[model samples]
Target: MKVILVNPPIYDFSAYDVWIKPLGLLYLSNILKTHNIEVVFLDCLDRSYFETLVVKPDGTGKLPSTIVDKPNILKDIPLKYKRYGINKEIIKNFFLENNDADYLIISCSMTYWYLGIREILDIAKETLKQTKILLGGIYPTLVPKHAYLTFTNKVDYIFVSSNFSELFAYIGLDAKNLNFTNFPAPDYSHYKNLYYIVTRFSYGCHYNCSYCACRKIFPKYTAKTVEQFVNEVYTLYNQTKCKNFVFYDDELLNFTTTKQLFYEFLKLNLPIKFFTPNGLNPRFINKEIAKLMYELNFTDPRLSLEFTSDFTHDITDKKITFKEFEIAVENLINAGYKPHQISVYLLAGLPYETLNDVFHSLELLSKYYVRIRLCELSPVPKTQLYYQLGLDDTVDPLLHNNSIFIFNGVPGKVKPWCSYEELQLLKKFVKDYNESLKQKTIHSYAHY
Candidate 1:
């Protein structure tokens, strides 16, 4: 049977590619190839399709988009919402040309982009009406109810598994023995054109922050062996001559794993640049790790300091301390990294958080001479906040959108302490603060 795998577009206020690839869908394509099933990969968000791409040298790029009408619920955001990706004609033309697929699988990410998913599903209904459609990935897993609400009538199934599970079995493969060793390396050769490569050295995360959905998506923390990592890196570089790589792991700069991975990295020393787009934990950075990162050509290292002070200890679950952040920044500086070479992520727009709190945090962070990234909270489903407020993704996926959520707070419980104008000012302050500090800036790298 012929299978078509799709990576849908993003409908948001702003979207940029920080080495974001449909890694799962790519892996699934190879798995289908291994099983001798004919696979057709379609990416609605293809960056290379447009003539003028905002792609940087490090594999990150800005998505091509058109300003879309704002959702009724999100009209007060004061920013233009967008449908970021290739145009509708491109999606329709692809399906129109190749409408013979037996099964169509779509991968979902960012719960708030549910509308994008629906748009693609609607296209599938119009063109590939005879074929079955399956939805999987973050959105379907975290917000199954919402997924069903939006897609139940248009699509045939919602996949909530971390693994292929019944998907492989349904495709007539022996699912019981499927593992990574036997799995084919993700096939990106089919992309419209070349960009940089993205790989994962680890899966899941060790810490379970109140704001994170890592535990639900990836229950266990798993790291690749040195040999596995080195071999994969060499294989990709040799095949594609792509030196830019973004590590997709939730956590990789930890003490124990860094020691092991660095030794192998030093030996291989493939002529490649590395990026830690998935914000590194400040507490994990030490002198040795910092030195190794610099030597290994790690660029755009961002420290994840969710909150500036212990005031949000209950909300952040005390992941890291201010003292720890200070040490990490110091270590990076001491290890030959300029203050501007690193960036720190601080959370803003949380429930019950005052603009005064963010201002004070900014004051303290600015003293360090490092770039500051103000992460507007996009309260995800299945996290502590979601449960605390009794919200599922079904409440209207648009509500989960950070672009809108940044302006409005939870419907009834509490509104953001800052007004829409105040929020804009805070965001502007962050942009200006980072602009003011020019410590060997290595381009902006966002983790999510």
Candidate 2:
């Protein structure tokens, strides 16, 4: 049986090289390949792949994109809109040229990128009428109702999890008790020109942070064994000869399983550098863990201190506070982590957040002498915040963009209080703080 997995184009006004990858889809592809099924991938957002194909000017393929149209909602801003992959025609041609697949699986990321998913599904339907098109990933998981009501008529099936065994059964493949036993690592060989390797040592978060959707999406925090994780790391390093690694785990520092796993990794002392693009829970960082991380050769540490809201943070996730956060930072510093080596993530523009609150958070973090990475709050479906606010369908998904704090729109004794100008000023303050940190020093410590 043949399986074609496609990562649809992104329609956002701005994008970044944030070590993002459709890991779920890639994992599924690897599993299918292990069972002797034909697996193919078409990543639309990869610039290297796009350049190699040489996509044309008219959103068609053969060269890299030059004229990117600004997204509809974000057109008011001064940024170029882009369809970040190969040309639509090239994608179409690739589909038609080798279109003998029995099943076509498409994976989506951000919920706001649904338009791109619809476009890809439409093209798939046109190219191969006989094949069954399945949709999965974050979009389908968070908004199943929207997926069923809207795309049910369009796609044959929608799966939220990486459980593709049921689909395999329909195609006469025996997929019972498919244990992680001998589970294959992700297949990145097809996209050889890729720069970084994005992998997950664990799945989901134990803490239910109000602003995070990790719990809703991956309710159970499951992790691979240390041996399994290290084996994959070895294979990836050996095969790709790439030293850079990015962990996409939601809770890589849960102290229970992940910490122990990292301890084992530090023993290896491989000449490889590791990074965590997703922020780590501050509570898990103790002197021992910090020393282990340093010994393991972690080049940069990404610490997450969303806000100094104290125990009220428990309202969202019963995790994090100024006390524990400071202890973690101190331990990191004691273990030889320079202030600049640590990147702290601060959440700005919360639903009812005040400018004073954000300013204070920045000031507090800057006092630690660490570089602050400001992230806007992007509301995901099924989160407490999303349901509590009673978000409507009319709400532009772009408004959920973290860059602009749309929730803080009302000003005072009003129903939906916050001014756009006020929110902009807050965002500017965070940006200015980040820029200033590059030039200023708040603390000093030895580097790993």
Best candidate (score: lDDT): 1
Per residue, candidate 1 scores C-alpha lDDT tens digits across 1-448 of: 8898999999898999877788888888888887788888888777889858766788778888889898888877778989888888888988877798889999977888888888888888889967888888998888888777778888777888677876776656788867654556678877866677877877788788877898888887766676777787888788888888878888887647567888788888789888877799888888988898889988979888877876685556667888988999999999999988888888887765677788878877878888887888888888987676566544776787776676676676436546778777787778767876864333222210
lDDT of 2 by residue, 32-89 (tens): 8877889888887766753446432212223244455655556554445555556688
lDDT of 2 at 205: 75
The numbered model that scores best in TM-score is 1
Q: Native-vs-model 2 lDDT?
A: 0.71
Give residue 192's lDDT in candidate 1 (0 to 100): 63
Model 2, position 190: C-alpha lDDT score: 70
